[model samples]
Target: MTRRTTLNLPQLRAFLAVVDAGGFSAAAAELGMSQSAVSHAVASLERELAAPLLIRAHPVRTTVLGERVLPHARMALSAVRSVEQLAAEATGTMTGTVRLAATPTVCQGLVPGLLRHWREDQPLVTVRVFEGDSSEVSAWLEDGTADAAVLIDPPPATAGSYPHPGVQLATDGYRALLPRDHPLAEEPAIDLRDLEDDPFLISPNGCEARVRTIHRLAGLRFSPTHRVRDLATLISMVQAGIGVTVLSEVSRSLIPADLVLLPLKPDTSRRLVLTGPQNRLWHPALRTLADSAAGHLAHTASCTAGPAVGQPLPSRSG
Candidate 1:
């Protein structure tokens, strides 16, 4: 006959905690259980294994066998946590943190609006935001550092694309930002080639990628005389007549009063995208984020300046 024993989750956790905490009493306090309960759990685990897992002494410590099993126990606990999270996501009873990553502009321009709406809907889901450059944002999703992201679309669909599910959130076009007294400021629509000689400024969060893409689309040589990474600083520089750059209309709220935003002759626009891991159902909170962002964009589409882009330029009189 073979001896068999089934170990419970409580037994495994108690055993690991007692070994780590160096005592039953400490593990009990950490687990919110009585010391006797903690001791019983560990004893149950030991009986299941048919081995002496710990040595009771002035200061409790694990035995050699316990040391060997500890790593496996930890891995099991981690797997259990993953299962629990997936189940929670599936049931839409999302609680705890939903980690998010986004480009700097999205962090300022879109994330806040989405989160504000999310707060009203899913108050139990805590969202944590991490701001990065475009590539960094993608890396966070792939590396499991983030549960979701707000990004510009169309995503890099080439080989080595972000391995995840994605959706478009909103559609908005770009416009040029210049000082009110700039030479071509009076033009109703400005061609990309019109400002060839002017010094260009790349706006907050290293919007160099968008600048490069615009140059490619327009078949023009593009170079920024200065790169500005802070939104407020970029606005101040433009207001001071430092240089000109393109901005998404959704970002109009961040624009200062002294600058002028003009439509582009050949319009260029972007669709905001939301993405999550491909391996599992997006954490319920992440799904909510995508839905909330889409709904917010739709709700704000008919009117300018509610949440995302789609705003008509403000008059110079203001």
Candidate 2:
């Protein structure tokens, strides 16, 4: 079988230093080690290199193969040390900009408050935010465009192979938005069949695809006549009587005064997960920000206090 790993540079260098100084005792004196210690280093190096590094019979002669590998081993050792030096400088100091990608709903609703909460602890770490859909957020994480990300778990049909298994921070549910004067707007919850023939306005941004999927899975028909990309625009279309739409609790704060938000019957929901590069360690500030959002923001993103998904609309008075 082939030796599966490249040579360990430090061990190879120790073996070379022993070879240069002739005998193990003399090499130890020159390299600042005990003779037995120098001998053990060479033994370990030979095992990994899969080649005899020294002939132990006399004044430590390099084996024929060891002489052939000396130059390459020295260069590899030099390159490894250089990388170690640079990494030592960057590993823990959390002072630079950290980039993150998020969906528009998170970008507008959750991110601002998360920044404020994180800033008190990480005053020096400047966070830059970018907006995208769930797929874009996960892609940014895989490609190194983002240091971390906040995204909805993609709908099963559209999910991609993400680098890291996400840490779910929250679950947001869907709601139906209607103009305050819509005939059935005061209902506690909306049955999909109630609006089976009503004109639908699909929210192209946020979790629009999710709403569509829920309708499909429920075996209901949702023929949207108008499509829009902004939450405010999605609401405006409903307000102007263009059509009705479905939104999630994350977007509840953006709803207008004239709109009635009630839970979507047989409620559909999605988990919000935090994603980032799998192998890299997060800087101190970045980890703190991620932790804060995961620990605190998850609970607060829902519109629990209002007459939205969790409660019934007020009764209309004469």
Highest TM-score scorer: 1
Question: Which number leads on lDDT?
Answer: 1
Q: Give the TM-scores of the predictions, in the order they appear.
A: 0.63, 0.59
Segments of candidate 2 deviating more than 4 angstroms: 1-93, 154-167, 279-284, 295-318
Clashes of each: 1, 0
lDDT of all the models against the reference? 0.72, 0.67
Per-residue lDDT tens digits for candidate 1, residues 1-318, read 998789889998898778755788977876779999998998888888999989997478779998888767765765675676678767867665577888766777777877888888778878878888878887766655566877666444333432334556657578888988888989998888888888888853555676678887888877789887776787788888778888876677677777888897558777667777554345545655555655565667766655544322111121
After superposition on all C-alphas, the RMSD of every candidate to the true structure, in Å, is 10.8, 17.9
Score residue 20 of candidate 2 by CA lDDT.
50
Per-residue alpha-carbon lDDT of candidate 2 for residues 1-318, written as tens digits (9 for 90 to 100): 875855565577577567655678876775567878877888887887777878886787878898887666655654554455356447743454567788887777667766886687567668878788777888766554566887676333212332224455556788888888988898998887788777888766566667778788778875788888776777788889988878777777788899988888867887666655554434334544555555454455453564322111121232
Q: How close is candidate 1 to the true structure, as a TM-score?
A: 0.63
- In angstroms, give how far residue 62 of model 1 lies from its true place: 25
Model 2: worst 10 consecutive residues (lDDT sum): 309-318
